[model samples]
Target: MKTIYALLGASLLSACSVPLIQPNATQAVASHYGTSAPQGGAALDVNWWSRMGDAQLTQLLALARTNSPDLRSAAASVMAARAQSGQTGANLYPSLTGSASATISDSPTTPRSDSNTALVDSKWELDIFGKVQNAAKADTARAGAEELAYAGSYVSLAAEVADGYVGYRACRLAQAEYQNALASQQDTVTATGSLVDAGLSASADLSLARANVANAEISVTNQRADCKVAAQSLARIVGVSQSEIDAVISKGGGLPKTKPFQVASVPADMLRQRPDVLEAEKRFAAALLDMKVAEAQLFPSLTLNGSITASDPRSWSFGPALSLPILDGGASRAGVRLANANALTAAESYRAATLTAVSEVEGALTRLAAARSNLASAQSLVANYQAYFDTVDRDWKVGAASLLDREEARRQLQSARITRISQSEAVLVQWIALYKAIGGGWVAPKVVISKDLAPKKIEG
Candidate 1:
C-alpha cells in the first residue's frame, strides 16, 4: 500500500536523523586529575621489576604471571567478554534457518502415503533506529573494559609479589638484628654470672642480665616466626610451596637496596596510562551505548521475513513485518531512564577512578620521600652510634667505662640499623605502590568499537 510505503519512508527519515550514541561518549573523560605528581622519568617499563636488576624478582614475577589464579580468572573474563561481543555483533546481520518434517497418512481404502516437507525461514530486522547496532557496540565496549581489567590485574599481581617479597626480606633483616642482640645479651648474662661468682656483682644483677637474655631470646624467636610467615606468603604469591619459598628467600641473599622510581609529571599522564582508568572509561562508554539501545526501542522496528517450502509444488512467501509498539505500560521510557541513570553512574565512576589513581601515585610519592628522609636519619644515627660505641670500647679498655656502657652504645647502633632496614622496606613498598597506580607500564589496547554498531545513516 502507498500508505505503508510512505510510513516506512517517514520512519527511515526520522530514525536516521540522529545517532543513538554520540561519539563523545568514549572520549568524555575528565580533563585532568585534581592533584599533582612527580616528574623526571621515561614511561614505565612493562616488566618494571627488571629495572631493579633483581633476577629472583623477575623469576618470581614470571611464575606469578603463569600461575596466578587471579590472572587466570581475569583472562577467562576477557574471553567471555570477547565471545559475548562477537555474539552480539552476529545478531546485527540477517539469519536463515532450515527445518524439515516427514508425515504419513492412511485412508480406509488406500495404502499409506508419505511425503517430506522442507522449509527455510529467513528473517532480519532492518535496525532503522540503530537498536541492534548500539547493543553490539555496548557489548564491544564491555569487551574492551574486560581486556583493560585483565591488564590492571596483571599490574596488581606484580605489586602483590613485590609487597610480599619486600616484607619477607625486611623480616630477614630484622631477624638477623634480633639474633645479634640475643648473642650480645647471652654474653652479658655469662659475664654477669661470673662477676656474681667472684663476689664482684650481686645475684640480683646477674638475675637482671639473665632476664635481658631471656627477653632477647624471645625476640629472636618471634622475629624468626614473623620471617617464616612472610616467606610463606611470598611463596603463595609465587605459586610455589613453602619450602620452595624458603629456597627463594635463601636465593634473595638479604634485604635488597631498592632503586627509587620517578612518577609521571601530571596526574592525567599517569591516569591515562593506567589500565583501571581505561577499564572505567570503557564501562562508561558501554553504559552510554546501553542508554542509546534503550532509547532506540521507543521507535518502530521493520523486519523482513521470508519462507520457502520444498514439495511436489514448491511454495514461498516473502514480506516485510512492521512492529509499531504504541504502548507497553511505559516500559520503554522507564528502560531509557534506567539506562541514562546507569550511564551517569558509570561516568561518575570513571571520574572517581581517575582521581583515585592520582591519589595513589601522590600518596606513594609522599611516603617514599618520607621514607628516604627517615632512612637517611637512621643511617646517620647508626654511624654516630658506632662512633660512640668505639669511644666507649676504648674507654672500657682503659678502665674509664663499664662493660654496660659499651653494651648500651652497641644497642643504640643496632637499633638505628634496624630502623634503617625497616625504612628501606617502606621505600620499596612505596615504589611498588606507585608502579601499580601507574599500571606498571602496561600499554592499554585500543578500544574496539563494533563497526556494524557504529553510528551511520539508516539504509532504508
Candidate 2:
C-alpha cells in the first residue's frame, strides 16, 4: 500500500509539471503620450454618450444595442464557446454507462434457459500525462477570449451609433445655415431694388443681387437633399425608419456637443481597458495551453476501466490501460510542431494588437486636439466677420459704402459661419473617435488566469 501511494504521488507530480514553450505575453509601451494632450485623465463613464447632452442620441443608441445584428452574432459566439468549454471540462471526470439485456435459449432434447443481465461500466482517463487537463484549460481560455470579443462588439456598436447620430445632426445644422443665408440674400435683393428705383444704383447691381438670390436658392435645395440622405444613413445604423429618426432629431438642436472625458496616463493601463487587446492576450494564452496539450500527447496516457454484472454468476472486473505513441507515423510529433508554430504566431498577433491599440489612441488624441483648436479659431473668425458685416451694412445705409462692398461683406460673413459649423461637427466627430480608441470605457472583468497556463518567455 505504501509503494502504491508513492507511485501515485510521483505520477501526479509529473502531470503537474508539464513544460510549456511560449513567448512572453508582455509588450513594451511608451511611458507618455504625444500630441500635447493633457496627462493624468480620470476614468471615463461607461455611459459616455450620455454626456453629449442629446436625448435623441441616447434613444438611438438604445435601439442599436437591442437590434444590431453584429452584436447578436457576437453574443451567440460567446454562448457557443462557453458550451465547448463545458464539454471539454467534463473530460476531467469519469464517465459511466449502463446496459441491460434479457436472453432465452431453447435446444432440442435439452432444457430451456432464461436469464436477465444488467451491468454498469465506468471509464476514467487518469491524466497522468496532463493531456486532458491542458486541453480543458485551453478551451476555458478560448471561452474567455470570446467573452472579450462580445464586449468589444458593444464598444464598436456604441461608437458607430454615435458617429451616425453626429453625422445626421451636422447635416441638418448646415442646412439651417444655408437657409438663413438664403433669407439674408432675399433681403439684399429687396434693398438693391429700392436703390435702383431711386437711381442711386446701376440696373446691373439689381441683376447681380437677383442672381445671388437664385444661387442661394440652389444651395438650400442641395443642402436639404444632403440632410435627408444623412438621415437615411443614421436610420440604417440604428435599424430604424428614416421617418422615426427625423421625428426624434427634430425635437433636438444642432450638432451634439459631447462633453469632455479623459484616459489613463499609462499606455499599459489604457490597453488593459480595451477588450480587443485583452481578447488577443487570452487567445495567445489558449494557444500556449494547446502547445502543452500537444506536447503531453507525445508521452503515454493511462486510463482505467471497470464493470459490474448482475446475473446467475455475478462478477466484477477492473484494470488499467496504457497507450504509448511509439509508432504513430509522426502524427503526434507533427501535432506538437504545429502547436508550437501556432503559439509563436499568436504571440506575434498579440504584439500587433497591442501596437494597434496604442496607435489608435495616440492618433485620436492628436486629431481631437487639432479639431478643438480649429473650432476655436473658426468661432473667433465668425464673430469678427459678423461685426464687420454689421458695420458694412450700416455704412451702406448712410451712403458711406457701395452696394458691392455690402454684398462682399455679406459673403465673407456667411463663409465664416459655414466654416464655424463645419468645425463644430469635426470637433464632435473627433471626440467620438477618441472615445472608441480608448475602448469606450470598457474594463476587463476579473478572471483568475493560472500562471502555469499563461504564456511566458522561453529560452531557445
Candidate 3:
C-alpha cells in the first residue's frame, strides 16, 4: 500500500510537469502578418453580400446559405467539435453511476430465497498531474479551430456566389452587345442588296455585306452560348434547378454597376480579415497544447481512485490508488518528440498561411489599380468613337459621306463598345478578387462550457 501511494504521488508529479511551448518558426512567419491587427471596419455583418448593392446577388447568396451542402457540412463539423470538447471536459470530474440487482438461490435443504441490492458507485482520477486539464485544453482549442474552419467555409461560399453572379451579368451584357451588332449587320446587308438590285452597287460590295452578316451571326451565337453556360454555373452555385435559373434569366436586369470605393490600406489589414488565417492560427494553438500534453506524460501521475464493494455477509471500505510509469521502452520520450515535431510543423503552416494571405492581398490591390486605369482609358476611347460615329451618320444622311465610310465608322463604334464592356467586366472581377483577399468578414468563435460538474468539497 505504501509503495502504491508513493508511485501514485510520483506519477502525479510527472503529469503536472507539462512543458511550455516556445515560439517556433511558424510563429515567426505569422508575426510578419501581425497578430490581432486592428482593422478599420465594423464587425462584419452576416449580410456581407448585400454590401455589393445587387438585389439578385443578395438573393443568390441567401439561397446558397440556405441550401449549400458545403455550408451544411461545416455546421455539422462545428457541432461535432462542440460535442467532443464536452466529452473531454467531463473527465475533469468524478463519475457517479448507480446499479441495482436481484439474485435468487435454491438449496437442497432450504427454501428458495431472494436478495435485492442497490448502490451508487463513484470514481474519480484526481487530476493532480494536470493530464486531464491538458487534454481538456487541447480539446477546447481544437473546437475553436473547427469553428473558425466553419466560418471560413461560409466566407468562401459567399465569395463564390458573388463572383458567379457578376460573371453571369457580364455574359449577359456581352450577349446584348452582340445582338445589337448583329442587327446593324443585317441592316447593312439589306441596304447593300437594294443597291445591287438598282444596279448602283457592285457584286463585291454585296459579297462584303454578306460576310459582315455571317461574322455578326457567329459572334451572336458564341455570346448566347457563353451566357447560357454562365447562367447554368450561377444556378449550380446557388443550389437551384436549371429551370429556376432560366426563369431568373427571363426577368432581365442591367449589368452590375460599380461603386466608387477606394482601397487605400496596407496588406496587413486584409490578412487580419481573412478567415483562413484565423483558422490556421487556431490550429497552431491546438498543436501547442497537444505538445504540452505530450511533455506532461513524461512525468509521474497521482490518482485518488477507489472502489467499495459490499458482500452478503459484510460491509466494505476503500483507499487511494496511485500509478507510476516505471518502464515503457522510451514511449513517453518518443511521444514528446513527436508532439514537438508536430508543433513545429503547425508553426510552419501558420507562417505559410500568413505569407500567402499577404501575397493575395497585395496582388489583388495591384490588379484593381491596373484595372481602374484600363477602364478609364477604355471609357475615353468609347466616348471619342461615339462622337465620330454620330458625325459620320449625320454626314451620310446629308449625302456628304460614302456608304463605305459610314460602314467603317459603325465598325469602329462597335469595336469601342465591345472594348469598354470588356474593361468594365475586368474591373468588376478585380473588385471581387480584392474583397476575397480582405478575408470576407470573419469573427472569432464563441465558447461555452457547462457548469454541471462543479467540484464538491470532500471533508476529512
After superposition on all CA atoms, what RMSD does each candidate show versus the true structure?
A: 6.5, 7.3, 6.9
Regions more than 4 Å wrong, model 1: 1-43, 103-110, 311-313, 392-410, 445-460
lDDT of each: 0.76, 0.81, 0.71
Q: Name the candidate that leads on lDDT.
A: 2
Clashing pairs in 3: 11-300, 11-301, 12-300, 12-301, 12-302, 14-299, 14-300, 16-129, 26-347, 274-439
lDDT of 1 at 235: 75
- Report the C-alpha lDDT of model 3 over 34-58, residue by residue, as the tens digit: 2222244444444455665677777
lDDT of 1 by residue, 351-384 (tens): 7787778778767777767876888888898889
Q: Assess every candidate by TM-score.
A: 0.85, 0.83, 0.82
Return the TM-score for candidate 3, rounded to 2 decimals.
0.82
Q: Report how far off residue 121 is in candidate 2 (Å).
A: 3.3
Off by over 4 Å in 2: 1-22, 39-42, 99-119, 308-317, 395-405, 445-460
Comparing 1 and 3 on lDDT, the stronger one:
1
Which window of ten consecutive residues has the lowest lDDT sum in model 3?
Answer: 451-460
Clashes of each: 0, 0, 10
lDDT, candidate 2, 357-447, per-residue tens: 9999899989888988999999999999999999999998877988789889988988898898888888888888888888888766432
**What's the residue-level lDDT of 280 in candidate 1?**
93
